[model samples]
Target chain A: MLMIIRLMIAAMFILTTPWSGLAEVQDESALDIQVREIAKTLRCTVCQTENIWESGAPLAQQMRGVVRDRLKLGHSPEDIKEYFLSRYGDYIMMQPPAHGVNWLLWLGPFILLLGGGLLLYKEVIGWVRRTPANPTAPPPPLDEQARQRLERELES
Target chain B: MNKGTQLTLVLVLLGLFYLFYEGLWGNPRHIPTVLIGTDAPMVEGPDVETGEIISLEQFKGKVVLLNFWASWCYECKVEHESVLELHRLFKDNPNFVMLGVNYQDKLPDAQQYLKEYGTTFAHMRDLKGQLAIDYGVYGVPETFVIDQQGKIRYKYVGPVTGHMYTKITQEIIAPLLKGQPVSTAS
Candidate 1:
């Protein structure tokens, strides 16, 4: 009877015990979600082209860890981004902040396109004005006599 | 194009060319740190030799020189002598304290490094690299000087030797220790 009770107890323990690792991974864990969201926005200082989330560099990995740790400490995502900006300056941002001289970077291309288009338009109008246009009267269709004359010249 | 318009276009072209040149030619190592003149972060870690926990808070009101170094960094080895000399120059001052941050290395390797290259000041082990990140340190052999007000007075990225050593000693640390103004100009 004791053996049967022990067997029942063992079965109950096995069935009821939670798998901590599997639970952490399978469920959309809040911390992992938060880390990914924040990491995706931050440029990896060591690898300038890649964000911390996508980069495999050890520094990037440590940065991801920092993001995770800070999130755990109740820092908002903006606060975390501000933290990095404070450390690495404007260069750290993947998108340069729209401030000061950086305004040129944001708007320079559009301004250039508009300016170039205007310049080209003016130049083309000038060329059209300067050059002679086709005569108003269409040239008479090539006469049979002219065609024959051209053919004779070719033969000669 | 009219004279004014042509001048504007030329100026715009020059500006764009300058930006392109900077993007291509600027040194990747020379990241401008924003922490200068800001409050220095208090860092804590285990003593590299003794394994006892050391906190930067205890060194408040002193001119703290935090040098970040690693076991494998060649520049750290190169600057090691000059770093020691700098410490020796100011170690007698009651207002000055120098802390060595052993960064991103194994415990045994760090202890071996301190053993091989004599260390006079307390060295802290940055186990998870949090301490280095706290100071925005991307590489070894970076140095920072914090003033009595706990603001980061100066930071140098590379090895401190030659003219750099002279500059840090006379122009930076000495002035801060005396509570005089030092230029934080970039």
Candidate 2:
């Protein structure tokens, strides 16, 4: 009877235990989500073109750790980005801030496109003006001898 | 095309060529650092050989030259001798302290490298690379010169040899040691 009671108690304990620990292992915390969001914005300085989140470089991993730590400490994403910017300059950011000389980098291509389009448009219009249209005069009233030869060839 | 249009096209082509040349041939290592003139981050790490904690905080009010190096980096190997020489030159001064930062290298390998190359200064191990990140270091052999007031006055991201060696010793570190302001001209 004691063995049966012990077995029943074990069964009850197993049934009553919460699965929250398993869930915690599977799910990322809110702080982790914040770290991911911030890490995705930073460039891996040691890497050619990878963001810190996607890079497997040790530096990138440390940077992700930094983001997680800062997020845990209540630093906002903007503050974190500013911190990296202050450290590594504009190069650390995946997107260069639109300021000063960076504005030229941002807008130079569009300005070039507009100017090139205008120049091409003007040149095309000039070509149209300079190019002579097809001669519209009636074909010299096709010579009578040529007309008779054409008709004879058609009949043959 | 009209004169104005032709001239504009020529200028645009010239600008594009200049940009292309710069994009292809420019020195990629010359990344401008924002840490210049900013307060140096107080960092600490373990001594590579001794495992004792070495904190930059204790070196406050002294000129600290932090050289980040790794055993595997070729440039670090190239600059090792010059680095030791620089330390020797300034080590006599009570206010000057030079610390080598062992970055992203294995313990045995780092110690072996030191044993092979020889070292005159204490090297702190950046175990998790947090100390390097604190100083905004990305590559090996990067060096920083901190002023007496704890502000980072200069940073160089390559081997310290030849002109760079002379420039750092005479121009940057000497002037700062003398309590004169150094130019931020990289």
Candidate 3:
């Protein structure tokens, strides 16, 4: 009976170990997903054209750690983002906030595109209007008499 | 296009080009800091050598020079001597305090660096880098001058050496210590 009881206890321990490991992994992955989501939005201050999530720079790593800690602390994603924004200003964000002078950055390209398209369209329309409809009818396709005269002139 | 429209178009294009040029080539170090005149974040960390807690709150009503650096950073090594000298120069002032922040460095390596390069001021280890983020630090070798009222008066990114050393000592810190207003321009 003691041997049977001991075997049962050992079996229970073995069975529970994998379940505990799985639980820990699931918890970590949930936290990791949150960290990645937040880190993706922050620009790596030390690296150009890379967000903190993708940057290998130590600073970016630290920023990711900060995001994870804040998330663990029950701070919302917006709060974490706001914390970074307040610290590093608009530059810290991957997408600059559409306010203040940053409005120019957000809208400048589209405004330029619209204005350029309008100008190009106007110029194209003007060119179409200025062009003769049939290009003077190709100079009346060179009448037979004109063709003969041209040939005679060339021969002379 | 009419003359007025053409002129406007040229002017807009020129403006856009200028902005693009500045964005591409401008020094990231010169990117203006928004922390100026704002309350400095009160932070704390363990001292690198002593393992004792060093809190910035204790230094309230004093001018604090917070220099963030790391062992792996080249510029930090370059400015090490100048940094120590800056501390020596201002250490005599009762109202002046300087603290070194060891950022993103390993414990053994940090201690080894300090042993070789030497440090006069107390350096606190940025354990999880929370201290650095709280201060809005972009990278190592960045310095900040917090006034008596805990307002960050000035911030400079990069090695505080040569002309910068002179500027911080004379133009910024000196004036602030003398109860005179200093320029917040980076």
State which candidate has the highest TM-score.
Answer: 2
Q: Give the TM-score of candidate 2.
A: 0.83
lDDT of 3: 0.89
Task: Estimate every model's Cα lDDT from 0 to 1.
Answer: 0.86, 0.87, 0.89
TM-score, model 1 to reference: 0.79
Worst 10 residues of 2 chain A by lDDT: A18-27
List, residue by residue over A1-156, the lDDT tens digit for candidate 2.
Answer: 999999999988777665656567555576677888889899888887689999999999999988887877888899999989988888788777999876765776777787777788888999999876766755557789999999999999
In model 1, which residue pairs have backbone atoms overlapping below 3 Å?
none
Interface RMSD of each: 2.9, 3.3, 2.3
Cα displacement (angstroms), candidate 3, residue A17, comes to 8.3
Worst 10 residues of 2 chain B by lDDT: B20-29
Winner on TM-score between 1 and 3 is 3
Where's the lowest-lDDT run of ten residues in candidate 3 chain B? Answer: B20-29
- Report the candidate with higher TM-score, 1 versus 2: 2
lDDT (Cα, tens digit) per residue for candidate 2, span B98-127: 999999999999999999999988999998
Backbone clashes in model 2, listed as residue pairs:
none
- DockQ list for all candidates: 0.28, 0.33, 0.40
